[model samples]
Target: MSRASPRYDRRVRLYDTYTRGLVELPPPPGPIGMYFCGPTVYQRIHVGNAIPFVLPLWLKRWLELDGYQTKLVINITDINDKIYDAAPGASAKLSTDATAWYIEDTGLLGLGRPDVEPTAVETVPDQIRTISALVDAGHAYESDGDVYYRVGSFPEYGRLSGQNPDQVEEQEPNARKEDPRDFALWKANKPTEDTWWDSPWGRGRPGWHIECSVMAEKHLGPEFEIHGGGLDLVFPHHENELAQSRALGHGFAHIWTHNGLLRFGGEKMSKSVGNVVSLREALDRWGREALLVFFLSGHWRKPLDYTDETMAAARAQWTDFVASVYDPSEERPARGWEALAEALEDDFNTPEALAILHEWRAAGQLELMKRGLSVFGLEIERVEPPAEVNVFKEARDAARAERNFEAADDNRARIEEHGWTVRDRPDGSVLVPKP
Candidate 1:
């Protein structure tokens, strides 16, 4: 491709945590493959867990809108210490149930799904083969039946996290480790842990980090355009994946894009602090558009607070967008969705894009506004008010024509009571269904 090609000139640029810079995305006609690290299904996911789910789905839609063929892969880690600890005897069943809940909950967000949602349990053979290759290459070691990655073998161990190799602290401390900083590739099964897989190391499950590496490779292959997750994964979870995959000579992801965590009451939402809000509860409270708009209110790389006040504001924003369709069309110079697209192209800045959406709405660029909202799955379908609403609307219209302002006001209140409002367009008064 020439440097003057649209691929080069209009390519999406995103912040890569690995490079610690805003980097140009590889231009496409060629498929852009993205791998997002998904939840470890020990329990039903929280609102914090849903950020990774929403960000990539939105990115994929935007890329497709820009003429790129995209494949998005989100992996589920069903085999992890969390699962074992959460459900001792029924770890497998718990993970299975939680995975189902995760799919059902995230599906409620109304965004289109990923191309692939591979589970760790389903890819054990692929993981073992990769781990064995790592062992053969002297990138890993076995001690007392457990397998661990030799961190020193990969000299660029802390490059992604920006910590010196010598300064990186031990992630998993076991006396049998060759080095204190080395992390588990395969953990030997415990007496209480019922979920075990047969591997070269022994009967044990793949470690948390290796599960993602294998699942990502199995679906998207050894090389891809982007690997994404929440900001919290930057250190050990993602760094380990980068080190292990690179050690095996796989090219892996070119860019690492992480979304900010969802915080509640000024702290990261945690079960320990008793502020954890389930995704289901959030969806139930705020509905799909408001919850999504809340996410859009903040840049993908910055923290967002989850409070009633914030959600209420998001709901109001969504109400404004929905109501715009009923108002008279103010045909201004067309934006063609380019202004919002420009915001997205410059590092996927969702908050700025959202502001542009508001501008489009205010400028009466309804068509452009709708086109932009669809990219983020914030669809606004204009529905007619019910028959009962029409009675009041007609009465209100007649009263206004007869110069009975008091009766017209009464009819307006009655219509609003039924969750419908009247917007007097240039054509006529239109009854719009309320949010």
Candidate 2:
């Protein structure tokens, strides 16, 4: 863990060959057990579903800045189908305490918290002891009270979505499923929705792809290291969670990645396409550092596109990189902040690490643009302004001394649209904006 700490660089090969469609798969050789596919809270999580919570919190903070040693888990399905269609009351203590209160409302959505969440109704007895050891090794089946999985008993079942469990069993089944490429792992207790209990396949629940193949084999085991989410769940939810962790013989994730999909004008962003928004209303109208510069402005596999002019150009490029790092202007130009630590050590090439942070803030170099905004999480800091902008510039100088020029031009355009700048003079006194 100390190879001269650049966090121990040189790793990043990355995968997602469009979800291993060709089956290459190889990445986790040392400490990297990730697993994301979380959240099914039936409501309020949007920011394009927190783009699978910031691409596994930027692949667990860029694989702990490359030194690895990550664990990462993020489960929480809370018994599927959008929490049984928004909780149609049933228990495992009400879908595992309502999906741990919708994943603590997504750890208050700034995306840095989750290390282990685990739900699917507290891993339904490890998904009924992993579908009773894949139905006593025949790779699963039950039928009426439901259990399934047999997509013709593995055989590299469509090798992660290249698709052909005999063409997904010639496509058509899905009534309660049996074999249109058999899926569910448990589900029987239907007196009319949600249910639970030590299942043999009776008091139902636990089937959305064996709750992340038994919570990634009970917390990142049976091989791990990267299995990210949302390139529209890479074909049939990570190819049926890689056929339920290779029908329980282990080895399901070894670099899968998947980000790309938060579009708006160019379409996509669905809540059945209402063009959904809500990362708690874009953090109550743009705040968590302009929602992490609108989720690091693209290339976590690509397709960005959201708008109100791309979140007012990512809140005017995070207010001109925090007013060019609080522009005190001592004229310190030399910046080459180790070329953004050599472009975030390549592979996390955030637009070439924001073009080495606009060539270190166009060379005025505010300490190499605050160490390239602290390795691209966008370092922030300089915000001040809210004394309510000097109480709206002393009520915009008592509304231009009561002549009330339209209430002093609406508190001088709301303190110059909250970034501030106002001056009125002619002895009326207003002046503010001088960060």
Candidate 3:
């Protein structure tokens, strides 16, 4: 395939409507502006929490690979309903403090760090400013220190989620809204939790949905490129974000991207389900690279099943790539990395990208494999090669005959380098790496 073609120059479609049935999705004219929903700092992020990270990271990398500059902003919701509930046992001083801990933990868990990591609390002033502007514009109201978006003010409120506002009004009468479909722009805080600056309504903090809208506007500008998060958040979260930004007469994201959930045994991996896998445990087991490799193997928009066996296979695959890289018979290059580039350009299709890499490795195009893998954060190196038992047997016999302990140890290393891992047996003999 010729690397330069008119079709190859087209913009990649990172967002689609069918996921949540969003409309008005076209690629941005300039750089792709992206905002992803980040973790709330209530608890250690689980493996399920990692699905969102993997998808966006790939999208960001693919955009750059496709020659489009990207500004990726991930907002941390420091203050939220969940954070308030979790604050009782929190040792941190501020909501931002707790959120920072979670962000650090996420990086440790092998989620590729975001370019601009902003927190909700840090942008409270901006959030207040946005709410104030909406109030001034008659799109929001102060109801006893609680600011709510006027769903009636925004006629296209339910368009993003494809839900009829009237239907929601009928079903959710007990909803926390002025109009049953109207969502909160700011929530009045109580004495027990974090409180904020005074608003026309009262002294309180920002709402859940408003945090992202304000943050995205403040950083990425009113009209940006891409907005993405978990599929679960598409309803009230992204929908409200879109309405709030657009109702203010500023451009919201041109396209919205979302990733599917990571399931456990056919059920969502939630704490209540008792299938919650901690990010710490997964990192400790697979290391960061293997965990990423495992996650990126599946399509971002597809539901992924996690299990012990699946992880083992990902590890094996990663180890093979590393071993191949270490092969002294091969040489690596830089320019011809377009094989993987094309795969990524096709909607960030990581599975196809990975297949191209495997094919390149098989054909001894080691440079291309190494280059493509580097861009995707999958570079593997060999400290030592796997050992061979036959070589070990030869070295063992020679060592026993000459009583040369040093030569025996050297040969043991050789055997270990070939692939068979060596273990010291009960009889003071070494066991080689098997399978």
Candidate 4:
């Protein structure tokens, strides 16, 4: 294994499921390939679903800052049982619409789209080829028009999941499977399903786990730097992907990083549970900066609970941070910036990095504050209000001074309508552009 670059040696330590420990990502000779599991586009994505999606974007930013070219791939699972069940005859349209919404909603968070986004429907041939290879190698079996991976053929079937093969329970029980633990590589066409693709096995669709393996390998090659998803997928979903890929004599992924799921009302926020807070809804109410603050408040590897009070706190903190951006200070404070970078380097510890930003702001180190925010992808540009804004502020303040409370309130409302906010200070009220 290559050692991490000197610039990122202390940072970029990630947990690897295959090794069952923290591993350093070595400096890449070429662009680093990162594949993160994306949404199965049956409907709108919620904040819970956004957690894992946002993680890779954040990692990509950090990697770029550390001087590594990164090629990020987040696949769209257009072909799935859920898509058919949700939209019936309109499955393809539903997937396309949901994918567009996913792009728009995540764009509001200020993280741009991934470099590559391959759809399962577009990669059917790749999936078929992989399944055919596994079968030719005796690692999988075809029975009753359905293709199932032979769990007994791969010795490390349960290694990623930390489950003994004997103790693992069977999922999607099929009578034709040679072993009960075997999982489907291709599901036989069903009368109730809406979409079908012709494959060597039969006219059917790719399995949920198999789509990701094929898509990731097709875009990033057999071996890649990182494969990431939610902690919930550590079971059969990711475990199956690992088995089939290894059986094909491929390296698959160097590290398997899973983020903790988001929760609401003490339950995992999911579409099935009907406890989801959609990304659009959250962004509409709290705005992007506040929502991002809420997300970064907790560690990425631990579960985050969504509550009104928590969101309110994040809003307040974001407001204060933005206010501090307008604070005038001349000092650069090199030590504070070094501390911020060090905190980020230590496994992307964002909370600690945020604390350092707070410290810099308290000390009136505007340069350091800017540096910190830039690293966190929270940088805000300073926009000076036009002459008309200053005139309105003067009129509003004069009305307040004259004890014309009614006039003052009206002036304040007009100022806000003009797309600026009035912040009252001991000396006077300051006008800032609405965030």
Top candidate when judged by TM-score against the true structure: 1
Off by over 4 Å in 3: 1-8, 18-29, 89-97, 109-112, 169-176, 326-338, 384-435
RMSD of each: 2.1, 15.7, 5.9, 3.1
* lDDT top scorer: 1
What would you estimate as the lDDT of candidate 3?
0.72
lDDT (Cα, tens digit) per residue for candidate 3, span 1-435: 444666455545554643543343234334778888988777778887877776777677766665567888987777777866766545235465656656776777443787888877788888888888999999987776677888888777677777776664332243456676666788776776654667667788888888989888888888887788888887888888888888888888877777888888778999888998877788888877778778878888788878888788888777667656533224444335665666665667788887877777766687677777777666655453323465676677679669998887787667756665544434544442333
In model 2, where is the ten-residue run with the lowest total lDDT?
A: 20-29
Q: In candidate 3, where is summed lDDT lowest over 10 consecutive residues? A: 21-30
lDDT of 2 at 15: 51
Q: After superposition, which runs of candidate 4 have C-alpha atoms over 4 Å from their true positions?
A: 1-11, 28-30, 328-334, 386-389, 395-429, 433-435
Taking the tens digit of each residue's C-alpha lDDT, what string does model 4 give over 1-435?
Answer: 764545544546787877888877775443789999999897778887887777788878877877778999999889988899898788888999998998888888887889998999889998999999999999888887789999998887888988897777798996898889999999989888877988887788889999999999999999988999989888888999899888999999998988888888678787678777899999899888888888888878889888888898898887777776664433554454557667665666778877777777777787777766765568778888777778878888999899898888888888888888888866667776665
Return whichever of 1 and 2 wins on TM-score. 1
Q: How much is the lDDT of residue 362 in candidate 4?
A: 70
What lDDT score is found at residue 416 in candidate 4? 84
How much lDDT does each candidate structure score?
0.89, 0.68, 0.72, 0.83
Which candidate, 2 or 3, would have the higher TM-score against the true structure? 3
TM-score of each: 0.95, 0.38, 0.82, 0.90
**What are the per-residue Cα lDDT tens digits for candidate 2 across 1-435?**
536645234345555543543232233335777788877755656777676776677656755654556778877676666655665674345555655555665566545676787777667787788788888888777878877777776777776557656776343256766567677777777665746675766677767877787788788788776787777776777877788777777876766777788888899888786778867677778766666667776767788887788888878777766665544334645645555545544545566766566666766667667765664355656556678877877887887678788887888788888877665445544343343
Backbone clash pairs in model 2 (N, Cα, C under 3 Å; residues 3+ apart or in different chains), count: 1
lDDT of 1 by residue, 61-136 (tens): 9888777889999999888888888998998899889999999999999997899999998899988998899999
The regions of model 2 sitting more than 4 angstroms off are: 1-9, 12-35, 46-52, 57-82, 85-133, 136-184, 194-206, 209-225, 228-247, 255-278, 293-320, 325-328, 333-339, 342-363, 366-435
Task: Show model 1 residue runs off by greater than 4 Å.
Answer: 1-8, 400-406, 423-429
Which scores better on TM-score, 1 or 4? 1
